[model samples]
Target: MSYVWTLGEQFEGKLRGVSFELLARGKKLAEELDTKVCSLILGHNISDEDLEELIQRGADEVYFVDDPRLADFQNETYSNVISDLINQYHPHIVLAAATTIGRVVMPYVAIKVNTGLTADCTQLEIQPETKLLLQTRPAIGGNIMATIKTPDHMPQMATVRPKSSRPLDKDPSRSGKIQRIVLKDELVDTRAKVIEFRTDDAGFVNIEEADVVVAGGKGLKQAANVKLVEDLAKQLDGVVGASRQAIDRGWLSYPHQVGLSGKTISATLLLTAGISGSIQYLAGIKTCENIVAINNDPEANIFGVSDFGIVGDLFEVLPLLTQKLAQAKK
Candidate 1:
């Protein structure tokens, strides 16, 4: 039987949020193609409850490989297992999150399986006539969106960006089958050993995962003014974001950059000052919930997409807003 499969990712025994998001996307595509949605997870010591959560979210079948050797994310082993699974099952389509793991493992799997892969797709759809997986992603420095399709490949593979779509609410009544798979010793063998893992404490919040982001653009005028953005973000219990222009001027670090060339954020609230929203910047925040723009020029492009627009100087507006939030806090 044909199946639409989503590769689930886990860290330290708990499933990542992107797993459910991919399942939600898979469910829609499976329905369109008249196939069942299956979720494949590879990890050690994964809980049964977590496996069951896949069904509650939207998978018709959950196939998991739990082995001690597969504990950490070893690219060689992961690519081997995933490629072997695709070979054995011959799924019609494969979806994974475009996170660090996905970006690293998917290309290897695609090469091993002799199939094409589209990375960092923002949108996915099943073409009605041919039932092809249409993968849409930014190209040419985010100036144009390119739609790709693997017409001849058995499993059309794509890695979608996290927060590109929301996961469906859990349904306790949803019933599905969970199966355990055992891989051959050869598949689990790896050449490299992960001796230790280290985290970078750069003191910069991951803007892509923030619930609220207050960004400054070139309109902030100088590096010192970036503090204004940081202060307001601090007041709102949010993280600071920056447009490409701001980052280009070295007002903020690259980690805080929000755009197609940088990171795509799905914050609940996005507030921008002095940013004349270019299409590249807009693509990064297309999924954001509420957008507020502040620009001295009323004709600024950012105002077009903003739910609230303020035609005033950011230097004047930011301090007042920050003070008001501070006063409200007191």
Candidate 2:
């Protein structure tokens, strides 16, 4: 039985932070199962130095399938190659980040292999007696958490949310082997071509990746007041986040919403204003290290979970905080 993690893209010419996060989690599971943690990388121009990073992060072995066809990610090709690799190795468990690529590729591979896959898993465990992979995720509109296992399948599969776990400290002394595989020519197929790739150059704060997140809820009273939230975020060099109700009110775009139905955040500091702290809303910010909330209502639910709670009007608090932050920066 082997624990396998799928690699994601690089940040600043290094492995994606999420890849290291998954590897650290995989290492713990592998240790419990007394097996090796393996990583699978499929891309064009993959270098040995990058491969070594995986080993340093805790992978016992790294599997590489370098092909020009894989230079750009295509659903059909990635799905086919991954499904083939699963069939060949028959690993006990496979994990991927719940990013755009993982969400697409893993589902296709699951269907191809006829196995069950739990998406956006919050927790993974190995059953002590049976050595079965136990996958836990939110269900029923985040009202309940469901634990699932693949009893009938050879390899239990799951896609974990990014930033849900911390990466292990890099040990330069750790070493591992790289196994290069030659993908069959017939496996590569392009049903749809990416003619051009365009990304929005506009400043958009991805709350999930933000180290500091400043969020506002419905307590601002009017949509126009959301700018206070935005202004504070900007002053702090942080991203803007909104509750589901704020999004519903059209005060902010859906991309900026953070909650169970929205993006989960693992920011170092999370500052919220006017949010009443619905259970669903709290779920998304659970990973945040420090939480500070401001609400005019002293009884607001947000105060219960907040590390520091301010009982005051957000209209008054936001401006003061923003000014203080700006002055501190100067």
Candidate 3:
């Protein structure tokens, strides 16, 4: 048996942290299956040092596919190559991070391979007797968790939630076999090409990457009330976040949204104001070290998972909290 993780492209010149997290989970699953952990790195001009880093993380073998066509992630090209590799290797289990790349690539590959794939899986385990990959993920807007398995599939595939686990400590001394895949002539063909790339000039803060987040929701009442949440976040030296309601109301942009449809975050501290927690929202912040909730309603579901809860109007509470934080800085 073999456990394979499809590694994603670099973010800010380093491998996305999710890649390492998947490696950590892959290591555990490989042991359970009595198999070797392997990683697929698909991109252009991948370095030997990077391959070694992957091996050190957990992979016993690293497959590197370098081609100019892979420099920018085109879904067709990436999924096609990954599907072909999976077909060839016949690994027992394959995992990918549930990032934009993985979300797009894995589904396409799954269709090509005619296999079922579980997306945004929060937990993974192998059945002791059956040896099936037990995949668990939030279902029905996060109200329930569905454990799924691809019993008859050659390679059980899943996209793991980001920040669900930490990477193993890198050991520079660890070594593994590195195989370079020569792209076949047909594999290089792609239907789509990125003509131009545009970036957000507004300086958006990715809440998923923030250590501290102050998020507001519909309980904020209106767009103007959201300023209090923003001010509080600034005082706390954190990024601002919003529930789907806030984003739909145009008080926050899509990038600032956090929940099942939004980004999964593992912040050290998540302070939410005026948000009555929904299961979908809670799923995104499951890995937060500490959650602080403030709302006027005493029965707000956000308090259920919060380390601390304050039952008071956010309009009054936020200013006081911001003031106290500012005083502490003095």
Residue range 1-330, candidate 3, lDDT tens digits = 565565655543356677778889998998887888888877777667777888898888888787776777788888778888888878888899888888888889889998999998889999999989999997666667899999987688999877667789998888889999977768765578877656674648768767789999999989998889989999988999999999999998899999988878878899999889988899788768899999899998899989999999888899999999999999
* TM-scores for all predictions: 0.85, 0.86, 0.87
Clashing pairs in 2: none
lDDT of 1 at 182: 87
Model 1 score (lDDT): 0.91
Cα lDDT of model 3 overall? 0.84
How much lDDT does candidate 2 score? 0.83
Ranking by TM-score: 3, 2, 1
Candidate 2 Cα misplacement greater than 4 A, ranges: 1-3, 7-14, 46-48, 220-227, 234-237, 248-251, 278-283, 286-289, 326-330
Worst 10 residues of 3 by lDDT: 5-14
**Each candidate's lDDT (Cα)?**
0.91, 0.83, 0.84
**How many clashes does the backbone of model 3 have?**
0
